[model samples]
Target: MSLNWITLRVRDLEASLNFYHDILGLPIERRFESRGKQIVMLGTGAQPKLELIQTIDQTLKPECGVSVGFEVKSLDEAIEYLKSRGIPVLRGPITPNPHLRFFYILDPDGFEVQLAEHS
Candidate 1:
């Protein structure tokens, strides 16, 4: 079976939308409400997408070990852009190899997000 979507229970819907859509440039595929939860799907028309769910209770503690990664055109450029927007890099521009580099940042709801570039 193929991966369809990864869901994140967020505390603030608007903040999450700003981070994913405005900051990261992910397009909002759709948004709707279900079972009293506001849900939003983001990314291109692809199988593996991001789903943000905002419930009435905004008590969410995101796991430190769980992080979602996205590929970037340039790691340095991404870092610069994030810095310009006042988003601090949580981790390094770690290079596992000569062709790959990545870094981590915390989302508005404290979820870790990794931005990487493969040269």
Candidate 2:
């Protein structure tokens, strides 16, 4: 089957929105409140690539060993932009090969986000 949207249970919807939408520039496809819960879908086109769900409990911890990766045009530029916004890079701009490079950063909810570039 084709891959569908990936969901993240976030502690703060507004903060997540700011990070993913305002900072990363992911457009909001749609958002709605249902059964006292907030859900927002974000992506570039008709189908949402990422979905953020508001957790009922703010103290719920995120699961470990999970990361979402985004392919970037330039790893250096991405790191610079993130640094300018005070977002810390948690790991390397490691080059496993001449054509590939990547780094990690934590989202507002402590989710590991990998930014990678491939030539």
Candidate 3:
């Protein structure tokens, strides 16, 4: 079986939309708005998309049991861009065992997303 999309509950629709789209450069496939609620679809290229749904919970905090590790060509460049934007970068572009270089970032909702170079 193949996995489809991962959905996230975002605190602020506008900020989340700006972060995932403008900041991260993920393209918006589609969007729907109703009853003060919003659903945003994000994708890179033609790959599977991520669903960002606005949350009604004002106190919701992004948690970590599982985190998405995104593969990039260079972690250094990715982290630099985030740093330039003043985003909180939790860790660094270190070679863990010579097979990967990775780091973590705290998204707007406090969710941890990792950037890595893996093969």
Candidate 4:
């Protein structure tokens, strides 16, 4: 079976939207408000969508251990783009093997996001 979607509970919806949609350039597929909660779905093509939900009175801290990874066409280009945007890279641009390169960056809530390229 294919994966459906990944949901993340965000503390500040607007800031999260700016980070994901504006900075990272994930398009918003849809958004809705329900039960005093605001939710937004962002993604494109056939990949799994990312859902951001903001609930009233929610105060959950981001877990550092969990990480979401995205594949890129060029690791160097991706790293340059993030650096140009003033986004800090938390980890390596090291090659795990001759075929792969990766780096990590923290999201707005301090969630680890990995970008990798494979040859």
Candidate 5:
């Protein structure tokens, strides 16, 4: 079976949207309100989408040991883009081998995001 999507609980829907949709450049595929929660799915509709959910009655905190990863064509360009936006790299540019390089950064709600380049 193939993966469909991954969901993240966010404190502010607009902030999350700004990061994922505007900054990361994911296109919003679908968005709607459901049972007092706002949900948005962003992706190209070819691969698995990233889902963001926000609710008013609950305070959401990102959990440890979980992160979402995306592949980049150039690790240097990705790093420069993030730096231009004032987002600091939390860890890495680590190379496990000659064919791969990666790094981590925190999303708006402080969830780790990994950007990797594979050669």
Candidate 6:
């Protein structure tokens, strides 16, 4: 048995669409609305990828302690891009250890996405 996909319940589809696809640069492949809800697929070139599905609650706030970590070629580069796009960084890429460095940022939906670099 294997996991297939994880769906995040998003309050605002437009806001999440810009954050995941525009700010973070995830490639959006498809989008559609059904049963009064919107769904968008983001391809990661791998199975068990992420799908951001939109619901009706626009004021919903995500619960604490749920984090998503994504690694990039250069954490600095990502930081710069995010800053330019007006995304606020909540923490640092400061060296926590010799093998780990991460910075956390809150998306529009209050989801924590940790951008980290492992050397």
Global lDDT scores for all candidate models:
0.91, 0.89, 0.81, 0.87, 0.91, 0.81
| Alpha carbon lDDT at 104, candidate 1 | 97
Q: Model 6 clash pairs?
A: none
Off by over 4 Å in 1: none
CA RMSD, predictions in order: 1.2, 1.5, 2.0, 1.6, 1.3, 1.9
Error of 2 at 71 (Å): 1.0
Ranked by TM-score, top first: 1, 5, 2, 4, 3, 6
Q: Where's the lowest-lDDT run of ten residues in candidate 2?
A: 56-65
- Top-TM-score candidate index: 1
**Model 3 per-residue lDDT tens digits across residues 1-119:** 66668988887878888887888888999999868789998986657788899987987767756466677887778888888998868977578787878888877888778888885
41-107: candidate 1 lDDT, tens digit per residue: 9989755889999855666777747789999998999999999999999999999999999999999
- For model 1, name the residue pairs that clash: none
Q: lDDT tens string, model 4, 1-119?
A: 99878988888899889878998889999999978799999999888999999855456767747777888998889889999988989999879899999999988877788999999
Residue lDDT tens for model 2, 56-116: 6777665567788888998999999999999989999899999999999988999988999
Candidate 3: residue 108 lDDT (0-100): 80
Q: Where in model 4 is the C-alpha error above 4 Å?
A: 56-59
After aligning candidate 4 to the native by TM-score, how far in Å is the CA of 54 from where it should be? 1.5
Q: Model 6, 38-118: lDDT tens per residue?
A: 899876666565688887776666765777778877888888988988887897867878988889898778988899988
Clashing pairs in 3: none
How big is the positional error of residue 64 in model 6, measured in Å on the Cα after superposition? 3.2
Q: What's the count of clashing pairs in each model shown?
A: 0, 0, 0, 0, 0, 0
Per-residue CA lDDT of model 5 for 7-105, tens digit only, reads 998888999999999998999999999888999999985799999998563656676677999999999999999999989999999999999999999
Evaluated against the true structure, the overall lDDT of model 5 is 0.91
- What does the lDDT read for residue 23 in candidate 4? 80
Model 2 root mean square deviation, Cα atoms? 1.5
